[model samples]
Target: MRFAWKVFLSGILVTVIALSLTAYWLTQAAFGTALSQEKQKALDRMRMLSVVVESMAAEYSFSSEEAELAGVMRSAATGDFSSAALFSKDRRALYGRAGESAPMEELFEGAAAGLCHVILARDGGYDMHMLMPVQLGVATGYLYLAADVSAPFALSDEMTRTASLITCAAAVAAGAALVVVARLLTAPVRALSAVARAFSKGDYAGRAEVRCADEIGELTRDFNAMADSLEGHMRELAQQARRREDFVASFAHELKTPLTSIIGYADTLRSRALDEEERFRSANYIFTEGRRLERLSLKLLELMVLDRRDFPLRDILTGDVRERLTDALEAVLRGKYGVTLACALPEAAVRSEADLLQTMLVNLIDNAAKASKEGQTVTLTGRCCPAGYRMDVADEGAGIPEKELSRVREAFYMVDKSRSRARDGAGLGLALCDAIAGVIGTELHIESEQGRGTTVWFLLPYGEGEADAQ
Candidate 1:
């Protein structure tokens, strides 16, 4: 069943059982008390009559005393008393009502030593029979009084009916009140269930809004937290899937461009005889496109190898890093690209594979050179710190926009696609750098402002000899 109904019915059932038992006990106890009180009243009247009889017997003979007692008892008869009788010790009727007396010995045999009483029910009316031993100086007899108890019985029955009605009414009221209380108690649970259903229907943003200082409130808080975590993870997975799709599409397009050019030109060179100048131009174009394809293939291979290969790290000084970066940038600078580079290096040993570190730095510096204008200096800066050695490649180039910075590290994602394509950039430079940084336990941090410049930096873990070098 639903939680609210379970709580409501459980509370109502408990109240009904407890109330039923209480009503039954109280009604029976009240009935018993009323019956006892009526019996006591009958006993008291019988004793009073015995006193009057003994007083008369003190001044008269046995027969005369008996006769006078009968007359007195008949005169004393009221609606409550139905009959009165006197019996001898030997079990014979002496006076009072005719055909109603019984053997005294048999009546008193099972009774106690003193006065005794019993309630006799007949024709829906109750009669209390009270037996007492009578004494007049030297004579002894038994007095029996039968008092009609139908009035007390009727009162008791009326009370029972009234109590039953009250009990039933109270039960209904208690059930209603308990239902309200159960609803109030289970409100938080129901809210949580609703949110859970919404979540099942793919609404990850739905949350329970119960707020209190109880276990239910704690559960609500935990459920909301779980929903938030699930939503965040799903968003990350979706973004990753989109990025993968974009990377495949871009990589295929890049490959197809060079292949189409190479195929078309080779077919021309094979199909027709051309002038020497035209022939050299087609051959040079073919070779140039072929070189670009080679470069793209090599970069892709390097990225795959770095991802799968676990290289052992060793300490390499910052001076060595500067030398490697200079050597890698030498060819690009020599062809009158007019990109000047300035180096500011501090002496420190960084803990990393020398080759991977060199690749990361070369990609960064090459990217900076490509982004810079002729004669706009690129600075290679380094410093030693407590935690590691830091390097920054700052370029006086058109800076990337803030919104595109976060996505620039993704493979085949470019801030300026046309410009990167003109420079033979496959847009895998930063992706390579980022993978290298992760393998070496670091992160690539990029900061740039539009129209000013871009700075790419990261920290390498300090080697054992780094402190001495610093």
Candidate 2:
């Protein structure tokens, strides 16, 4: 059966058994007490009658054979007796009701008391039979009395029927009440079960309502917590799936662009009769595209490797960061882009993989220089914090729009696709920097406003060697 019904039926069974037993005991006790009291009252009346009979005998001499004896006995008998008789010592009935006889032989043969009381069954009813031996000086005989007890017994039977009916009604009410209570108790559990089923079927929005301060309430709370966690994990998984799909499509497109350029130019160099300048230009174009492909391949390999495991770290100072940024800027943009460098380096040291850190810095500075107008200053700043060294690379160029900032670190995503392609950008600079930063225990934070500028920053844990040196 269902849980509520099971509990209801069990409660009902216990109530029925308990109340029935109690009712039976109480009714029996009441009936027995009343019957005993009635019997005692009957005996008391019989004793009083014996005393009257003795007085009558003392006043007048009487014989069992005399008719006057019956008169005396009838005069002494009270109206409570259903039948009255005087039995001689020899067991002969001298006086009684018209047709009734006292069963003296069966009742008094081995009896010990001068007053004998017994219950006799007749015509499906009961009679209280009392026999009292009477003594009148030298004469002795038995006075017999019978009182109907069927009414009292009938009353007891009626009480039992009434008690049974009342108990049944009470049991039903208690059972129904218990069923409602059981339903109320299990309601939260039922709601939780439904929520779990819905969540399992991919409907994560369902939640359990916790309305009590009991174990069930605690369970409801725990269920909601687990559902929240599962929903979050599902969302993360979906985002990761979409990221992988976008990465594949972007990678294919990025690869196709350069390969197509190299192939087209190589075909021209091979199939066309060209002058020295035309042939040389086509070959150089192929070489330049080939070199761009090489850079993309190398960055892709680095990102894949960074994702797979932890990298070793070493002590490096913020001064070292400044020097590296200067050398890389001079090598890539010193005389080419007219990009000016500005530095604010502190005497702070950090723990990091030096090569990965340099590559991350190089990518950030290169992107910054590429974004800047000629004669615009690209600022590189580093300082010590309580936990580590923090660094910023900011460019005075067209800033990324706020909406596109979140995806700028995703592979092959660029804010200005055409500008990036024109500048020979493969759109992997920030993605590579982000991957490297993660490996080195940092996050790349990008902040920008359109028509203003963009700044990228991160922090590195303080090195143990630096701590000891300080």
TM-scores, one per candidate: 0.56, 0.56
Ten residues in sequence with the least summed lDDT for candidate 2: 300-309
How large is the C-alpha RMSD of every model relative to the true structure? Answer: 9.5, 9.0
lDDT (tens digit, per residue) of candidate 2 on 354-407: 766776777787788778888888888887776667899999999998889879
The TM-score between candidate 1 and the true structure equals: 0.56
The alpha-carbon root-mean-square deviation between model 2 and the true structure, to one decimal in Å, is 9.0
- Stretches > 4 Å off in candidate 2: 10-22, 54-68, 97-105, 110-114, 120-125, 136-140, 161-180, 205-207, 225-470
lDDT of 1 by residue, 320-423 (tens): 77864654455345343578877888877778876667667767877887787888888999887666788999998999988898899988788888888887
TM-score of 2: 0.56
